[model samples]
Target: MSEQFHAFQTEGEGTGSLVKRTVEDLPQGEVLIKVHYSGVNYKDGLALHKKAKIAKDYPMIPGIDLAGTVEHSDSPDFSKGQQVICTSYDLGTAHDGGYSQYARVPAAWVVSLPDNLSLKESMIIGTAGFTAALSIHRLEQNGLTPEDKPILVTGASGGVGSMAVDMLSGRGYHVTASTGRLEEEAYLKKLGAEEVVGREDVTPEKIRPLDKQKWAAAVDPTGGKVLAAILSNVKQHGSVAVSGLTAGVEVPTTVMPFILRGVDLLGIDSAYCPMPLRKEVWSRCAGSLKPRHMEETATEISLNGLQQALNDILESKIRGRVIVNLQK
Candidate 1:
C-alpha cells in the first residue's frame, strides 16, 4: 500500500478542486520527491482560474515549481535523502505537478539544491526569481553592465519584477522600478530600487519608433503597452529582456528603436532552458543573484490556503511570491 496526499486539481474550465490520492496515482518517473514547498506563479493562478491554456489535461496538479528531498530514485545522479529543486519542464501544465505533498518527476528535470539555499528559501526564489536571474544573464551576455546606465524593471511590485529589481540593485546598478502600485514605493525602495516611479511615468501617450534614450537596459515582465513603451524609449545599444505577458501578449511597436538606436530585445523563457545552462543559472541564483530579504518577499500558505491565494494572484492583488508548504 502507498501513502496518500492532498493535491489541488483543475477539473474543467473555470473550476479548481482539491482531491486526495495515493502516490501510485502519480505518473511513472524515476525519482519520487517528498515535496516540502511549492510556489504559486501567475501560470498557477491561470490554471486555477482556467483563464489561460496552462492545463493540457483535466484533473491536473498546477504547481510549476517545487523543492523537496528525494525519497526514491532509480537514476544514479540522484539518491535518496538528497535535497533537490525542480522547475518548468512541464511539471504543472502537461503533467501532475508539485501542488501535492509528493511528486514523481524525471531525474533530468531535477537540480541539486545549492548549499546556500534551504528548501523553504528555494521556494522563495521559485520560478519568478529563476526567471529574473535568467533575464539578467541574458542581458549581461548581450553586453549590459552596471556602468552602461540605469536599468528599468517594469511591474516591479510583482514577483519577477521585484526579484529583478533587487538583483540589479545588489550588483551596483542604478535600478528604476516601475509599478502601478505607487503605495508600494517604500517596499520597492527596500528591495534596492534607487528610483520608484509609476507605470504611466514611463509610458507616453504617443507611440514613436524611438524617443529619448532613458534606459540602457530593462527587465520587462509586463507585456502590452508597457513593453511597447520600453521599446520606444530604450537607449542606444540597450537591451530589454522580456519574460511575462501579464499586461497582454500582443506587442504593437515599430522597428525604429532597433533600426535607429541599435537596441536589442531579448526573450527569456526559463521553462525548457537547456540543462547545463539551467544548472549554471540556479547555481548563480543560490549565490550572488540571491535576492536580499528573500523570505520577506514571500508569504507561505498551505494546501488549504491555496484557493484564496490563487484568487489573490489572479486578481493581481498579491505581492511578491506565495509559497505553499505542503508539509505544513
Candidate 2:
C-alpha cells in the first residue's frame, strides 16, 4: 500500500523545503518503518540549512533519529508491526532520514524499541540523548565517578549537553553546566546541574597546552576552543568525552594535557558504534541514565514546525530538545 508522507528534503545547494511524497519513493532497505516520531538535532538543523556537510546528497530527508513501527522487513529478525528506533549510520545524511511519516532503513541500522521507551519517548532521547549516555558510559569505564571531582558539561543548553548534565547528575556526580544563556541558569539547575557557569568561564586566555586542573571529567559537545579549554582544565588522569564540532572542528591545543596530565580525550561516534555496545547503551538509557525530565528536556513539534525549529537550533536560540511528532 502506498502511503503519502510529509518530509523535509534538502534539495540542491542545502535548502530544506517541505515535500509531500509516498512510501514507494523511499530507498530500498530490508526494513520499512512507519515513522511515529523524529527528533531535531543540531546536525538535523545543519542538514535543513545545508551547512555542516552532513547531507551527502541533495533531496535528502534530514532527520538523524526516528522511532516507529516495522511495516515490512525482508530480514527474518524483525516482524511487521514491531516497534523500532533508527538513528545514525548514514540516516538523514547519505540516506533519507526520519523526517517523514515512513522511513525505509537498512536492517543493520535498526534497534528494537526498548520496553522502557515508547516510540515518542525514544525520539525524545534520539541521537543526542544516546550520545550523552555513551559519553558517560565511556567516562565511567575510564575510571570516572562522582568521587573523582566535579564533572563539567560544555554546551549545557543543547540536547547532548543537557542530557549529559541530567545523566551525570543522576549518577551522583556534581555537574557544572557551562552555557552562554544566563537566562537558563534556573533551568539548568532544575535539570540537576549543581552549578551553572558562563561560557566565558571555560574560555581560555591563551592556547595553552595545560592549565590549572579544574574538573575531574568533562562531557563536551562544543568542540574547537571549548574542547581545548576543557582538556586543559581536566585534572591529572581525568577523561573528557568529546562529541560534536558545534563550536568548530579545529582543536588548537598542544599534547601537554594528554602526555603530562594523562588526560584522556574520548571520542564519541554514535553512528557506527558496535551493535552489541549500542544495545547495551540503550538499555542503560532506558534505566540508570534515563533523564528524570526526559519530557521536560524536549519540546514536541509537528513536521510543519520543523523549519522554525531548524532556524532556532542553528541560531543557538533553542534550549533542550525538539521532538517531531509525525502523527501530528
Question: Per-residue lDDT for 1-328 in model 2, tens only?
Answer: 6657788777745457778899789998999999999998988878754456778878788899999999999999899999999999999989999998889989999999887888888877899999999999999999887888799999999999999998888989999999989899999999999999999999856756778889999999989899998888989999999988988999998889989999999999998989999999998988999888887799999988888898888889888999999888
Backbone clashes for every candidate come to: 0, 0
Cα lDDT computed for each candidate against the true fold: 0.89, 0.89
For model 2, name the residue pairs that clash: none
User: Whole-model lDDT, candidate 2?
Assistant: 0.89
Please give each candidate's TM-score: 0.98, 0.97
lDDT tens readout by residue for model 1, 1-328: 3866888887746556778888889988899999999998988888754457788877788999999999999999999999999999999988788899889999999999998889998889999999999999999999988898789999998989989988888888899999989999999999999999998898867766677889999999998888999998898889999999998998889888888888899999999999999999999898878888786688999988898888887788888989999998
Q: Judge candidate 1 against the unseen true structure and give its global Cα lDDT, from 0 to 1.
A: 0.89
Cα RMSD for candidates in order: 1.1, 1.2
Model 2: per-residue Cα lDDT at residue 49: 46
Best by TM-score: 1
